[model samples]
Target chain A: MFEIRWHSRAGQGAVTGAKGLAEVVSTTGKFVQAFAFYGSAKRGAAMTAYNRVSDKRIINHEKFMSPEYVLIIDPALIHTADFTANAKENTKYIITSHLNKEDLVKSQPKLEGKEVYVVDCMSIAMDTIGRAIPNTPMLGALMKISGMYEIDFFKESMLNVLRKFPQKIIDANMAAIQRAYDEVN
Target chain B: MAEKIDLLETEVWDGNMAASQAMRQAQIDVVAAYPITPSTPVVENYGNFLANGYIDGEFVMVESEHAAMSGCIGASAAGGRVATATSSQGFALMVETLYQASGMRLPIVLNVVNRALAAPLNVNGDHSDMYLGRDSGWIQLNAYNAQDAYDLNLIAFKVAENHKVRLPVMIHQDGFMTSHTAEGVKTLQDEEAYAFVGDFKPMNAMLDFEKPATYGVQTEEDWHFEHKARQHNDLMTKVYPVMEEVFAEFEKKTGRKFDLVTNHRLDDAEVAIVAMGTTVDTAMMVADQLREKGIKAGVMGMRVIRPFPFAKIAEVLSNVKAVCCMDRSSPGGAPGMLYNEISGALYNSAKRPVVTGYVYGLGGRDMTVEYLKGIFADGLENAKAGKPTTPLQQFIGVRGPKLNFL
Candidate 1:
């Protein structure tokens, strides 16, 4: 079983990212569950979403207590939310941030040994999608680190899921995913 | 009986989306709805289907849930297949018309995403609204997850529209727990689902001009006693058979079997838990863990909350030494609803179990495995001693005070 927790502000589409990843993974005939937790939702309050992927059926519907990977869509939440709550020794982090990995490690020494990759998701979204919606790029960085699916395959599946959106938005999101996939270490 | 559902397509849908899809497949004639959190998406998605031409139906946007049900009553009484969705406060607002719908035998299907009633104003999952509507004369069916949320809506329409059971039905799912959580749901072909639900057979419809009818007539002291007696007794007795027939037909068509009350590993068990909605799944998980430790633990999930399924419940729980009834709604000082109902069901049984009440996870708090284990551990101790370890009724997982009342 693999679990991923997402942290973001209300409008950042962290829930969508988690759902997109779950949808993509489910096409492989794996069991997947995705959900978000919030209270009195507002425009910019902290929110959390979760996804569980496994070869076996998942029976537990509660929030993920031990996530193997934690993805931070809003970098500011790193200081506010406990992004690493119940994180295991080998749990990895994929954080959307302007800072490099070393700078992030310097700021939070607790993240030194565990695999931490920081990508400038906002810059990628600005350069590609013309917006600061960083969820797509975060998923792109996740595609690189997790190897859950081929980057092209993941992008195609995501676009298929986003077919309801306008063509320009789809193209821009695809571009953002590609840029983040190529650039994130 | 062997005809199986061909998985022509599968979609990952939350409970609201799945229920909306079911409504569309049923080819409902009208949907009069007012948006409410956790349940808004069911109606919203149905409206989307209408606009996108997936369904040719009237989507009436109303000012409040009361008006929504009033509109549904208007549409359904006009011989149209109608449905709507609501939760928590919206449901509370609609309570007045719920009795009207059922008393008039309108057969409208309401998708109730269960949520807690509020003063602090929470938008999270619980069974408070579901419990509130228990005596409102609607047939109540509960779903544990998204797939059940989808399937039960279809089943609800069939059972509600049955000639013998022409009462409105409320198909309940835990708000947000099932409504917003996405999981793979195998859908029947639109044609198959429509065939399974069949066509609407309007009974005493207002639109039948040839045969005039009057609905919602006042019943004064002279006739009110018989009117209510017939309605309540017919509901308590006739609904079960119609539900069984519909469930049997559904299983034959789709290979998913449903029972009034579902038991997991109850045979040869000494300790058990009776619960509804999402907690049923949680209790089942804990029961498995208890069995791993060689404890004779079992779970009873109430598939039908109304018509209370007393006989089935008593038959299943008779031999258990200790039973915990998990209620997700605040009892407000009384013994929990499920606890009271289960005790009433077991009142005359040959072997009485030590039934206890547990009010837990109100307002969408997670009923963690650890908390559930604590419950089971306590039940185990009670079973060994042949009595409750704590007070007969206590709230679990709440903060600040450990509220216990007889």
Candidate 2:
């Protein structure tokens, strides 16, 4: 089983991003689960969402996870939430921040020895999607870090997931994904 | 005819969405609901379907959960298929009407997203609401995942509307754990699903004015006992066979087999964990891990909670040396309900196992894999000792202190 955890605020679309990832992975005929824990949480309050993918039916429902990948859509959550609570030794971190890996580690010493990748998902979303919804862009960075799918194929799958939106909004999202996919370091 | 919905062969859905789709496929005539947390989406989605002309049904918006069920009872008695959804406080408010729906023999399907009742005000999943409705004369069916929630809703209509067993049915899924969690659910086409549920056959419906009949008739001291006794007898004897027939036919059509009780790796096992809802699936996973370490572990889940499945439960656990009854609801002051029921079931067995009770996951507290491993470890010890090594009834996953009671 492969587990991924996302740290974001209540309204930031972590749950939507996780479900979108699950939707694409499930099309490959693997079982997937996406869920979140919100205990009467309000907007802007820090929260976490999760995704699990496996070849066999996934049945474990515990909120606790030793996540293999950690995606932080809200950089401030790095200070607020315990993003490393149940991390695996080889867990990979893909974070949305203006700071590069060096400055990020210097500011938050807890990530000193971690395998971290940086992407400006917030700015990417703002520039391409005309909004600060960093979730889709975060997924793009995740794809780059994990190599879970080809960039073009992942973007196409996401188009179907976002099919309900207007053509312009969908195209903007596609651009957001591509920009973050290429710009992540 | 209701408009058909085009769906993918597999759709990503939460438990609430799955249930709503089932309601739409069943092509229900009425859904009177007052929405609440977690469960709100089930009816909300149904209302959307109604608004989109996908359903030829009345979506009655009522004031409270009491009125929500009261509307369902009225619509059902008027000879239309009816359903609703509720949880926690909403369920508590519907308690009185629940008995009415059953006593009147109204075949209203209720999707109960199980949650904890509150003075502390929790909106998360637990079996408190499920346990509260156990004695209300409804045939309760539990779902461990989104797919089960979908399949069981369709099955509930068939079972509840059966002429031999005209009782309201409740399909329960864990509140947030199942209702809010999204997963890939294999869906049946609308035509296939509607055909399996068939058409509603309203017996003694008030709408049939030519054959004028009475409902909710007052039963005084002379007849109340007989009324109660007959209802109890039918629940004990009649519902099981009808359920068996429905389950068999469903499996034949859909290839998803359902039984009164779910047995996982129980054969040739020495110790087992008995649970319900989503916990059953987790326990089954843990049982597999335990087996690798050479402990013969297994799990038994109750699919049919109201009829209790006494004989089936006993037969399944008859061979195991020890058992743990993991009840997600608080027992208040006594042993957990499953612990008491399982003990009673095995009281006369020829090879009775040592049974222990565990109270866990109250108000949506996480029942991690580690806690299940600990429970299985105790089960192994109890099996070897031929008695409980831990306390007869203990709480798992709670903080502050180790709490146990007799």
Candidate 3:
């Protein structure tokens, strides 16, 4: 079983992204539960969504206070909140920021030596669409770190589930997801 | 006022302790709590029970209401009969978990003591907090007074975990009216309570180490929807008789009978008042005075609010000319949330009577007998013309129609 936590602001689509991932991973015949803890009940408030991926049926429904992975959708939160509170010792960190691998590690020394992958998801999202919803890009980065599933499978799931949104948005998200899956290191 | 105290059986405690004791009596193996107002007392009592060896359970002291409920989902899935208590805005924080627990098919019991959801921040009695999660797939029950609070709790656990109808149940009562009010509560000896309701053996539990089974695992669209449909049909239809049977069993054990709904005097009445919770008392009084003055009116207190005794309401109120529903909540984009659900249930009947719904109390504005007199008067006046007399959830006895009746 793998417990993963996603940290982002409320309006940044982190919850939606986590839920979409769970829905996609469900096709693998694995059990997954995705949820978020949010306060102020408003957009832009810092929020954390969680996912528990298990080959066997999962019964532990609590949020990932102690997680195997932390997927950061916004770099701003790293300076603000202690993202490592519940992280495990060999925790894999997937951070979405403009900074390269070296400076990102220097910014948070505690994360040094951990399996950390940094990606410029914001630039990717903005280049693809006009806005900064890096959830898709971060998912791509998560794919690179975890290597659990094919990028094509996840991209297909995102397109299938987000069909209700405009095609441009869908295409852009698909592009963002694809680029992060390839470029993140 | 010096409160009257009693002892001997359990412990000398008040209503909060009573709720805690009931949770314990029902054999709650997992409890998640983050102390807040009105609700804080119950959690404190829970901690007291845990410390004094009152309950054999894991109490996860969470940092926030969201964590409390999330932990409860975990513990409940672990195959333990899990429970929690909260009120007002605390309930708001619990809303997401509320839906998740239901969809995940976790049979957890929550005591939603009614308190005001605030903008001005008043910690008092009201239904607005729980009102937001009305459609959260919980078997909602409202207790009129203290005894109802205790008895209904016992019934809640039984109904919630029944294999035939595995659904969460929310037992709500006025925050102070029942949460703090001292009343004579008959707590069966642990053996008696346990015996009356068989040991809760969760189906396909996550905690059964001997025969390990998966809980909250993913399902295909076909299987997922199937489980949900089965849950709904069983709870909505099969539960009708089960509700009566459980109530009958409870009555036999305690010599106290509870109807799915209690009808006032609807035989020859033209205007009928419908409500739930402590407001029922004021409604009954006003209904009595209205009948005396030849208003041809009556009141009906709805106890079982979910799988909401709609058939009974239709059977009883179909004969009445016009029925006025005094809802304590405002449904977004509509008038009353309960009123809308009730109306939808009654819409298809051929003898569809006129249904007038008004948002009666918001933010726990007092619903005294005098205020009820005005509500009945409004309903009676509206009945003559077939329309609503006042807004559905406006604060009574307050100036400028607070929130302008939503």
Candidate 4:
């Protein structure tokens, strides 16, 4: 089993991103679950979403998880949310930030010895998708860090998942994914 | 004929979406709902389907949950297939009409996304609403996941509308845990689903003027007792056979089997956890882990919540040495509902196990695997001690001072 948790504001599309990842993984005939803890929260309130992928049926429904990957779409959540809670020994942190990994570690000394990757998902989404919805860009960074799927295959699968959108919007999201995939380190 | 909405063989759906799609495929005649959180999507999706020309059904925008259920009851009495969805306070508001629908034997299908009733105002999953409706004369079916939510909606209509058992049915799923959680659900095609549910058969319908039957008639002391007795009797005897038949036919069509009680590794186990709703699946996973460490752990889950399935409960737990009855709802100064029901079921049995009660996950508090592990450990201890080593009833996963009540 593999688990991932997302730290983001309620309106930042963390739930959508988690469901999208579950959708892509489900096509591989693996069991996957995507859910978020909604606490009567407003749009800007800090929140969390989760994903579970397993070879067998995924039956655990508890919110607690020893997540293998933690994706923080809202950079400020790194300060507000407990992203390191219930983390595995080798848990990887893929965070959205303006600063590089070293600078981020310096600012938040709690991540001093942790395995961390950084990308400016907000900037990437604003430049490509013309919105601060950093969810897709965060997924792109997750792809690069986890290598769970080939970039092209992941993007193609994402196209099907996002096919309900207008062609122009879909193209912009694809570009946003590619830019974040390339830019994250 | 309504337009058929194509679905993938396996679609990623939350419990709310799955239920709404099932309502659509059943080709219901009317959906009267006032939406609530978590459950809002079930009716919201149904309304969208109505607007998008996928369903040829009337979507009534009622003012409140009371009006929502009244509209369903009115439509059902008038001889049309009717359904709705509600959660928490909405369900509470609909409580009076719930008894009306069941007493009148109007087979209205209700999708209840179970949530906590508020004094503090929460919108998360709990069994408070589900427990509130237990005595309302409805056949309650519990769903553990998105797939069960979908499949049980279809089955609820079949079981509720069976000529021998014309009772309202409520399909309960954990509010945010199941209703908002997205998972891959294997779906039946629209035609296959509709065919399985069949057309709605109305008995003593108000619209059938030639028959001239009266409904909601006032019953005095002379008749009310007999009416209640017959209703209770039919629920106990009539519902089981029809439910078994519907479940068997459903399995023949879909290769998925459903029973009054679902057991996991209990045939040879000494200690067991009996739970309902989503907790059942979680307990099964923990039971498997406990078995790896040779604890002889097992799980029993209630699929049919009312018409309580007492005989099945007694039969399944008869062999286990100790049983934990998990209740996700607050018991209000008493032992939890499941604990009372299971203990009553075993009271007349020849081999009565040590029964323990656990109150957990109130108002959407999380029930972790660690919590369940501790519960099972207690169950094993009780089994070994031949009595409860822990308190008779205790609250799990709650903060502050530990609370243990008898």
- Model 4 lDDT at residue B215: 82
List lDDT for all candidates, in order. 0.88, 0.94, 0.74, 0.93
**Distance from true location, Cα of B377 in model 4, Å:** 0.7
Residue B298 Cα positional deviation in candidate 3, in Å, after optimal superposition? 1.9
Runs of candidate 4 exceeding 4 Å displacement: none
Q: Is candidate 2 or candidate 3 better by DockQ?
A: 2
lDDT of 2 by residue, B119-147 (tens): 89999999999999999999999999999
Clashing pairs in model 4, backbone N/Cα/C closer than 3 A? none
Which residue segments of model 3 deviate by more than 4 Å? Answer: A1-185, B1-15, B219-224, B292-295, B384-395, B401-406
How would you encode candidate 2's per-residue C-alpha lDDT over A96-161 as one tens digit per residue?
999989999898988989999999999999999888899999998888889999999999999889
TM-score of each: 0.97, 0.99, 0.63, 0.99
| Higher-scoring candidate on DockQ, 1 or 2 | 2
Higher-lDDT candidate of 2 and 3: 2
Which scores better on lDDT, 3 or 4? 4
lDDT of 3: 0.74
User: Model 3, range B198-267, lDDT digits (tens) per residue?
Assistant: 7888787876778887666688975988877876787688776777889999999989888888788887
Better of 1 and 2 by lDDT: 2
Q: Among these predicted structures, which one has the highest DockQ? A: 4
Q: Put down candidate 1 lDDT per residue, B84-161, tens digits, no spaces.
A: 999999999999999999888889999999988988799999999999999998899999999899999999999999
Lowest summed lDDT across 10 adjacent residues in model 3 chain B is found at B1-10
RMSD list, candidates in order: 2.8, 0.9, 22.9, 0.9
